[model samples]
Target chain A: MTSPVVEVSHLRKTYPAAKRGGTPKTAVADVSFQVARGEIFGILGPNGAGKTTTVECLAGLRRSDGGTVRVLGQDPQADPLLIREHVGVQLQEAALHDKITVAEALDVFGSFYSERADPAELLDLLDLTAHRHQQFGKLSGGQKQRLSIALALVGKPQVAILDELTTGLDPAARRATWELVERVRDSGVTVLLVTHFMDEAERLCDRLVVIDGGRVVAEGTPSALIEGLEGDRGVRLRFADDGARERATQLLAALAERDADVTAAVPIGDEIEVTGTRKVLFAVVQELAAADVVPDDVRTLERTLEDVFVQVTGREYRVEENEEVAA
Target chain B: MTAVETTGPVRVNHEGLRFRAFWTLFGTELRVWLREPTGVFFALIFPSLLLLGLGLAVPDFSKPMADAPPPWNEAPGITSYLPTIIALAVGTISLTTMPVQFATFREKGILKRLSTTPMPPQNLIGVHMVINVLALIVSAGAAVVGGMVVLGVPFAADPLVVLLVLVLSTTAMFSLGLLVAARAEKGQTASGLGMLIYFPSLMFSGVWVPLSVMPDWMQEIGLYLPLGAAAQGLTMGWFGNEGFPLAQVLVLAVWTLVLFPLGVKLFRWT
Candidate 1:
């Protein structure tokens, strides 16, 4: 087997308490993955899900308390000076000097490497030519994001680690950046991207690992992962009265028995939910009508990656507003 | 990937890489500060402006004191203010400007951005140090020449000793500034600390009262502080009356020794 360009095994990191004597919180726990050469790999997670910490450890920005990580076949922390020159990193919330112009920022960063790409080419590629002399503080949100990407690519690094790569970009700009990433990959640079955007992961990633509560909940190609989410879509039905509700419940049970695809028929409060394949909903509505029950409200929930996330992690994918762990 | 230079026992272009990296960042830093004319105002212009303002307001300041007292014998009133003006150059650049700029860069992640590459981010701090040193030199030179032509204060009676005192005093003050930059995590904290240090150090440089005229208790305290020692050293150099202010110079040297390492150790790139 060919060696992976990046490999992380049994990784763990914990942050000290925010207060003087509070208990420490683990930011990453037992995370493991490997990135093959030339692949556009991804770490997909909600805010504060240890995605950033995992990559920060890879970039040697944060030292992992346990486990091992090798990037381009060397330890990033033990040999940061050697590793730094070969890897390009775009930090999640990092900023440039407010007064520094875009062109000057590019020039200074480009000089840090022995072999660097022509910055003018990168400027044209990222569509930052017009704003070359504009101060970083004056650029629009998308412009700032593009300039940041430009700086990351300026060194012509072997692997690029981009964290939250498209947070502030407009939809069109986000798509454009995705295409740019594809081009970077085509030229044979391994990209390790961290993002919460499902469409971005599906559209760009060759393979990805889903992180939740500082652990790897799922990992695979986007389609395979979604398919492995038990391929569930739910049909929620509410009846007008208790008689109709009970009738509907029996009918769902009867239908689930006859159909091989109906995975579950469960009562959630005053409603009934039938979960299975796409055919389950059609079979369910037909059986309900045949039983002479009229439903007051009915809704269909299709399984996307977002749903897959909930299924695997057992929680909604939203910002962890109360994470004691810090930035 | 070919973009990554493969590992080998021998490294090539080490010198070329060093020179290129240094000049690129160093020159860019110089240009960035050049855009900010306010640095000139604070470092060079402030000292002379303060002197010109004070010289005009006080009539007897321009006239040398008659039958000067033992310690004040070498220092007339206006002559004392000239060295304090030079000390002002050292104080503002070191305490106010250096710490603020250093902390702002770290707060903004400018230093973090640079750290991802082969270049060490703290070299950015070195660039700032170089520029501030140059500013101190220019301002000190301007104060000495301006005192001679504008205020009729005599030139340094011992030029070599004056330069040596300026170097030692600047090292002392900037080391203190470095310590503040190392510990301060935010721009607000850096500025607050800078101002806290700047005002007291300015006073101790003895701009308002010649140390010889100050109460015994105050002089006793001021002599131990870097700025106070600097004030006395510069005045002694101006009078041509010193071998070296050994006690005062030692005080300044000790401060540089203690603070510079602590600052470098405490500084966080991010």
Candidate 2:
């Protein structure tokens, strides 16, 4: 059997507590997973979920207290030098010296590898050719992120790891970055992406592992997880007036009685959202038709990955911690 | 062009990884130092100013005894002060610049980023040391020239002795700076603590006052300090004096040998 591009087993990391702390913090605990060659494997989690810690261990930046991590079939801890040749890493807060020009930084990083991709080509790929002579500090936030990806690709690594690739990007730039990631994967490099954004995972990841409280909570394709939660599907109905809303509410109540699985009827804005399984949803629609309670808009939508996450983990998709969002 | 072979023939190599890593870090240090005029001014100009200011302000006591002879009469006072000024300057740059640079690099996540690469931590420190040593030599030369021009100080005819003294003194100061830089948690703390060491060394090593005039016990204690030994060696070299104390050389050497490895061991990349 062919070996996986990346393999981790029983990885653990614990840090000593600070003064006035109750107990030591376990950043990661016995986490294990494997990524097939040329596939985009994502790590999805909330803040403080140990996603970054796990990736750091895989990158050989932080030493794990226990367990084995192998990248490209070489031990990251024992053979970090060998592993680095095949793996490119773009850390969340990593940056170059402010005064260093983009081209110079690329050249300098390129020199670290025995075989390197053409700097000009990389710059063009990341849409940074125009900023080749500009200083690193002078670049915009999106430009800097792109330049970082260029640096990582310079080595022509077989495996690339990206942490928070598009956390602060606007929608347009985020879409561009997603396309860039797909291009990177198409070049035959396996990708290990770490992000908290469920939309990003659903759009880009072939498969993903959800981490919470320093352990794996779930692992599967985005479609599979959403499919698993389809039984709890819901329909949102919008009405033109309060009278229409009242009529829809009475119709939903009757539908709930007919279908035992119709768990809740929620009122949102000028609409009443009905939630239940496929069978329950069908019964609700039939009952509404029988009552002639035709609403302004009625749409059936399956549970998204976000909804599945909320149901299983009992937490919403928290894109920002309070401190980070304030900053 | 011959079909630019881009397939299996193209393989990542690690043959020159060590050299490449070292040079990249070394270039980074030099580039940053060159770009910052304030840093260059303090590292180079401050020592020159201290040497000229103190040498001219103080009396020339190289003449024969008026009151049982000034203790520094055996050597030209300016010459004695010159080495201490150089040592202090070397210490200032290494301790002040290195730790601050390291701390800022850590705070900026540059060190953490570099750690993900194939480069070892030793290469990072080695590059910093190399760049610092080069800067130290350049600053020390300027100080010597400044002393000669401003204070009319004479050079030792024995080039070998001068070189030896500079080497030993630089080694000692560099080790001390490394120790401070490695231990300090923050840039401000490193700079403040380094200055704490710098002021005392300047006072006790006879950079500001003649060590010979100090009490006999004070002189004995100063002999053990690397800065004092360096100052004395430079004095002996510049005046072309014989009977330069071997103990001073030994003391500086011992400090270099002991502190350097300890500094490296304690150093934090992040």
Candidate 3:
């Protein structure tokens, strides 16, 4: 196999405890992942899952206490200036100078690179040409996010690390940003995106590493991760009348009790859902036929990445930074 | 021009990146500073206003003092205010403006943002220092010209000594400001602390009450202070009395050497 564009091995970082005599929190412990060339790889995790810490290590903003991280075949920490030339970044909490105009920001940031992209083209791509002269503080949240993205791309970097890329954007703006990420990937710039949104990771990432408690619980393409979960794909059956519903429920309960196929069977209103191995489907049809209660629709339910995430981490998957509608 | 390659990492030749980065940052710093009403009022306009207003309006400022003692001779009050004007200009830039902006930029994550790029945070500091030095020089020139042209105050008796005093005094005051900015965790706190030192230093530096007319004990105490030493040194140079003010130069030097290092050590990029 070819070496990845970015690789991290056995990364460990511990933040000192805030209070006296308290044990220091291990922010990242033995976490490892890789990003291939031209792919939009994701690091999906909840708050305090070391997503930012891991990205910081990759960006050379933080020095890991243990393990090695290489970016483009070179150590980011040992030779950060070299890596910096090839790595563009849009930090989660950073803002440009309040009085700096959008055009001026792009112009200045572009000048920092030897291989600069056309600021005008970037402005047009991000839909920021109308606000070229607008001061950064005067721009709306969505506009600010777009301007940061423009600044990040002006260097024409080989890899762009966008942390919490669409955290504060509205649904429409979030979708637009996602499309922009896709376009960036298409243009051959590898992306390492850190996010907490389940739908976002499922939609944008070619492959992602789901981190929890500073460890990688699962890593794969979104569909593969969901399919790889050790459980039956969900099965649902709906019946018209109360009698049919009860009969369906009883049949599913018997199947679950037998433990030959179904793991758990539960009734919801006039419907029954049986969760078990793949063989549970055949078993459920046989039971229903035996009961002679085929007066409803039956279908296999597809599991979402959120469900897989919950299964792997043993915790409810929730986005820490709530999305707000831009005014 | 290198062809735009749509492949793996492009090898960039950074021949003039350093100079371009510094020059661009300096220009931006100057541009942003012009937008600051508070900074403009203090660093550029305030000193000239003091010299022009007091020199033209207050007849007593240019007149010789009454109640002359045996050893002490009467001098026009405008001469005394000169040192204070210079000190205030330096103090306002170093103490009031520098710390407030540095801490605010740090709080707003501007410094951290630059850190991720080829530009380091220290470049911001370097840019600010160079810009402020140029600004203070212009404001200082305005003060001198306004004092001489409007009030008819005599030119410096020893121009070189006056220049030395201004340089050393600015270094001392700015280093103190640097220390405040380095230590304060937030913008407001830095501003508050800077103002605390600024007001007291301004008063003792002869902004409000002339050091010449202050009570003996108070004058003695004020002479040892940074602004106090500065006012005395400049006044002595302009008047050509007490050759070189060796003590004043020593105080300013000691403060610069000590405070500048401490400021650098305590500075936090985040």
CA RMSD of all predictions: 4.5, 4.9, 4.5
TM-score of 3: 0.90
What is the C-alpha lDDT profile of model 3 across A1-327, one tens digit per residue? 456888998899887866799877788887899888889999998877888889888888888899899888778877677677789999887567788899888878887777789988999989999999999989988889999988889988889999898888899999999999999899888999999887999999999999888889899999898878786677888878888888788778977998666898898766788888888888888888987889479889977788888898787887662222110
lDDT of 2 by residue, A234-254 (tens): 788887788868987987877
Ranking by TM-score: 3, 1, 2
Off by more than 4 A, model 1: A234-275, A281-301, A321-324, B1-13, B68-77
Residues B145-175 of candidate 1: C-alpha lDDT, one tens digit per residue: 7777777676777878778888999899999
DockQ-sorted candidate list, best first: 1, 3, 2
Q: What's the i-RMS of each model?
A: 4.8, 8.6, 7.2
lDDT of each: 0.82, 0.76, 0.83
lDDT of 1 at B191: 87
Q: Whose TM-score is higher: candidate 1's or candidate 3's?
A: 3
Residues B83-154, candidate 2: write the lDDT tens digits: 677667766676666666666665666766776666655666667777777777778888889877767656
**Which 10-residue span in candidate 2 chain A carries the lowest summed lDDT?**
A318-327
Top model by lDDT, which number? 3
Which stretches of candidate 2 lie above 4 Å from their native place? A16-24, A168-172, A279-292, A299-302, A314-327, B1-17, B52-80, B210-218
**Where's the lowest-lDDT run of ten residues in candidate 1 chain B?**
B3-12
Off by over 4 Å in 3: A235-265, A269-272, A279-302, A318-327, B1-15, B56-59, B62-76
**Of the pair 2 and 3, which is ahead by TM-score?**
3
Deviation from native of the Cα of residue A24 in model 1, angstroms? 2.4
Q: Best DockQ goes to which candidate?
A: 1
